[model samples]
Target: MQALGPWLPDDPALPPVALAVSGGGDSLCLAWLARHWRKNLLAFVVDHGLRAESAQEARLTVQRLADMGVPARLLTLTTLTKGPGVAERARQARYAVLAQACREAGCLDLLLGHQADDQAETLQMRHQAGSGPEGLAGMAWMSALPDVRVVRPLLDVSRQALRNTLRGAGLAWVDDPSNQDMQAGRVRVRHSLREQDEREALWRAGLQAGAARMRRDDSRTMSFARQGTFRPEGWVCLGPVLPEPEDLSVLIRCVGGQIYPPAPAAVRRLQAAGQEATLAGVQLVRWRSGWVLVREAAAMDAYGPAYAGARWDGRFELFLPSSVSRESLQVGPAGFGLDRTVRGGWPARFCATLPALWRHGQRVGIPHLGWWAEEALQGAGFLFQPPVPATGGGVYGWPEARGAWFAAHHI
Candidate 1:
């Protein structure tokens, strides 16, 4: 294995890492290498619980690490599908759990098992889809992934090297049956990525075009920040930020993609709703002062349930709605700060006194399920109500990056 540097690109210190191990050869190999490099590393194994022996595999993976004198934290979750789109839902859940673990552990860099082959496969798949430049860009080396920074150091490394490393270290991993299932889109893509040279050419062209577009997008995003004209919900009460008359849809897409850019019609409707009420979900809301991207039921905020009809006093349980949103409640005493964490436009001090309020959970909401309402709110440090100024936007109280332009805000 190549020696890891004292730092990841542009980062300082031998920062503690959180490795996302899946008990596969790829991830297990990564865990092995990472632990060898940094004593400060923390291993995080997530069991999707899709297979029968999934939890057992997780235990085994953890045990292997322990034998290496590396202890791991296991996070296992059942894949649930109430409706269609199980795959996407499962991915969202996985990342949500990983991000939470990273946060709790105070680890900054979250490492993944993606290697060059994964990138090639991704590029191949997207190219066939005739994807735009952005889509063809494939996996980024280091980027933000909800509550965490994701680093794919192996993007430059071949999969064979990872496999070889695992074997050399006497590690055995599982071969997921799903990978061989031709019915899977990715498997088909993998097969074709190996066969069609012409397709690979097109994909490479797409990647080049994508890189250019990313540069443009970065520029445009800077412009958007400077323009300071996107709003969805911070404490909401904003009008929609969509364009008028419906045809100029191009103006709605965000360069940063923090929220779903509303269609002109949707934007206008949300604008109307803000006056009389509020709209849920991530949408471009037009604030009277400006615009902000309002987050609704943000996938990153998928924690426990929301606290509805809950109490305070450090010993309470807030129940979540069966159909959940990103919004949550913080239970606490008076005089706590009122920020984005709580529900009402009110602060913690004011909202704490409310016999009937929680805090804002995240940037968005759907009200997941509030099944066991009675047993939950037995105690309360304080329900974190969603943050206020609901007319979404970070309260940096400064101009956008372009506007500020110190070069320190962003690289």
Candidate 2:
């Protein structure tokens, strides 16, 4: 509870804090601990529906949470099916639903129950996969998502310790059979860490790596603040010289609206190829003085229905007034043939990647450029809301690093 201080808020009048309780021993124990720490808490139990008993387990989890005096909701994923990369698919779906639920519930922080054992396994798996230093850090105590902040309070606690806590309270938890499946990479790593010495060594290594990552992130944040200029049109302007690979990668992720940055080697290659190049859905072009990093127009998302709060291209968000009719309205890229006079001197390539409102195949609005087809469409707006921050997500649990990050990003 003391360690969760930085991640949780003290104000009771604000929105409730959320928890991701999976009915497993680890999450159940987390819920149990959190109930005592705060009065206003919401739990979300996600049902992937990958097994015959998943729905039942979710329901039981909800009931258990209710018994503990914590309100909970069951989120059932219907689109996921068994296939290649099913585990990754399920994980992504789970987070998406969790984030959506948090937004609807007015929750800012979502607590996850990733314990020390899971962290050790992640470190081992990433080591085998040739992951970089950031990957070797395993998981951060706090991570920023597009819709919410993910906080892992039990990252320092062992799995067995959580089960022991539940047992001490005379509580029972669901045991998922999939955890023992040998075909899974994490399961194999878990089995291999049967020796206490090996697990401890890996856990220590992850902690050291996390500390190093925090330092690097601080330097990157400083570099971005001094040398990077972020535009509201979803692009960036760099200083005379390109930033280091780590700082450049952060800029690429922000401009490209990608959840993860390009690999370190790929970023290095881009830096070496000083000429105009495209990597990770972003184009680095030479502009006046320094450089301009913009979204690759060719890789933008297809047209989608335009509503009051529609998000397009994962880089811009749409806002339409209630008086505006959404019928036949779609949001897509503002192509080259559109009126360039209203582009406010921004490059045509940059304007081509801007989100525009279309009606019956005609460009109706390019909000950022202040162009509209009619007076009524003037109320339409597009906000540059990229998937991740320009300075990268801050480190949690480390007060100095987290504070530095928050100050740098103005969060």
Top-lDDT structure, candidate number: 2
The alpha-carbon lDDT assigned to residue 173 of candidate 1 equals: 81
Poorest stretch of ten by lDDT in candidate 2 = 402-411
C-alpha lDDT of residue 55 in model 2: 94
Candidate 1 residue-wise lDDT, 1-411, digit = tens? 222223543333544678888878788888888777756677888888777777888899898877776669999786564455656677778877897788777777788898756766877776666554444566655564334567766654556678877777888887777678787777887777654344435434534554555565555455445544432212222223432312112232221123223334454665555432223334343445644443332211323333443422211224445443324444322223334444344333223232232345322221211112333333322232331111222111111222321221111
What does candidate 2's lDDT look like per residue over 249-300, in tens digits? 8789888988767888899888877888999999999988889899999999
Model 2, position 119: C-alpha lDDT score? 79
Cα TM-score of candidate 2: 0.90
Per-candidate local distance difference test: 0.51, 0.83
Off by over 4 Å in 2: 6-13, 396-411
Weakest 10 consecutive residues, lDDT, candidate 1?
A: 388-397
